[model samples]
Target: MAVDLPGGVFRMGSDTHYPEERPSHRVRVGAFSIDETAVTNTDFAAFVADTGHVTVAEQPLDPAQFPDAPPENLVPGSMVFTPTRGPVDLRHLSQWWRWKPGACWRHPRGPRSSIEGLEDHPVVHVAHADALAYAAWAGAALPTEAEWEYASRGGLDGATYTWGDEPRPGGRIMANTWDGPDFPWRSTGESGFLRTAPVGSFPPNGYGLHDMAGNVWEWTDDWWTSRHPDDATSACCAPDDPRGGDLEASYDPAQPQFRVGRKVIKGGSHLCADSYCLRYRPAARRPQPVDTGMSHVGFRCVRRPATVEGTP
Candidate 1:
């Protein structure tokens, strides 16, 4: 199911949080409808069955993309999060993230893992191309970053979280974020989920949309930018449906050798923890390489109103 939002002006970013969300700005968006939850395994399976689509994680890595890697390591695989036995240096993400061969949406954990009992869970291990393919099959489109943040707010203007100003109102757990402070090691499973939770496991926001805060990081249509543009100086100058920076500008300057473009992925995942990536809020975002899909990343689709009879 989908919820239709009468989009309008809303404060888009955060001024008090992460640097990337600096210079909170005003943005206007047109009316659109969005999926109530991230695309579930069942939904993705249907799309694959109908279109015979193959996710990028299931395809061999392009030789041009990984020239420095050994030929034996070029096999199909996806990044999987494996908790460490104990705490380690948080600076190095490699400690917890491993490239597991045969870890596609079908086998989320690895070759032996299966999605048999996870049909209702948000489908992970979907690269940008895979998400786009699913969106196309459903006759929908991935939401722009601005549109996504707007809907995620759920009419709660300037709220830190999707629900309200507080992360957990009335001392109750709101979303399926990391269960404990010892991230990359242990999860208390207090949120009743060590990883991704079933959709709608928590209460919906004011728009009646569920799973907007946490569960899995969701893909957006915008290219990755280090920070948002400055707030408009005048009401008339405010951007309407901003799509973020160009693809050329989205390349990771730190890794010049690998010219892979990145896209903006919003909404924190189950891996988000207060002691670590405290980003289960509306404005938080991160850059993800177009060709990579981790076990904690999934996507939802949006249907924009046609500008004309045949136009997007």
Candidate 2:
């Protein structure tokens, strides 16, 4: 089911959170319809079966693109989150993420793993191209960063979470996030799933949209910008349906030679924990390479009402 959002102006970003989310701004978005839940494995399977679409994680890597990569690592695969045995440095993300060969959407854990019982779970290991192809097949479009963040807020203006200021209101888990201590492996099981939970498993937001704060990070159409543009001086000057930064500006300076532009991904995943990555909020955002997919990353689609010739 798709929920119709009566779009309007809203305050976007956070003034007291991650550096990237600073400089909170106001954005105007048009009315649109978004999926009530994240795109599930069953939904993506139908698209693949009908279109014979091949996800980026399933295709072999081009040697020319990664000349310095090892020959053995040139095989098709995607990044998978493997929790460490004990306490480890949280700064290094490689401690829990591995590039397992053949780790596509179908084989989430690797070549041997299958999605037999996870049909309703949100599909993971989907790169930007894969998500775009699926959206195209479904006759929908990926939401822009502004649209995504707006919908995620679910009518809540400046609340810290999709639900409210408290992450776990009344001692109840609202989304699927890592409910554990500082250690990456330990899980409090409050969210009910170690990895990706079934779509709509958690309570929906004010807009009746599920998994808006957690479950799996979703792909957005906008390129990643370090921070949002400053708020317009007046309502008449507010940006409408802003697209975000350019491809050149989205690249990571540390990997200057990679030449891959990143898109803005919203909604933290099951790996998000307060002790570590406290990003399971409506204003929280992350950057993802267009060509890379991970076990904790997935996406949903949205559709905007057609505008009349002379309508604003």
Q: Each candidate: how many clashes? A: 0, 0
lDDT of 1 by residue, 2-118 (tens): 999999999998999999998899999999999999999999999999999989999998888778889999999999999999999999999999999999999999999999989
Which one wins on lDDT?
Answer: 1
For candidate 1, the C-alpha RMSD (Å) to the true structure equals: 1.4
State in Å the error of residue 270, model 2. Answer: 0.5
TM-score between candidate 1 and the true structure = 0.98
Each candidate structure's TM-score, on Cα atoms with residue i matched to residue i, is: 0.98, 0.98
lDDT, residue 148, candidate 2: 93
Query: Ten residues in a row with the worst lDDT in model 2?
Result: 182-191
- After TM-score superposition, the amount by which residue 154's alpha carbon in candidate 2 deviates from its true location, in angstroms, is 0.9
Model 2 CA RMSD to the hidden true structure, in angstroms = 1.0
Off by over 4 Å in 2: 310-312
Candidate 1, 289: how far from true, in Å? 0.4
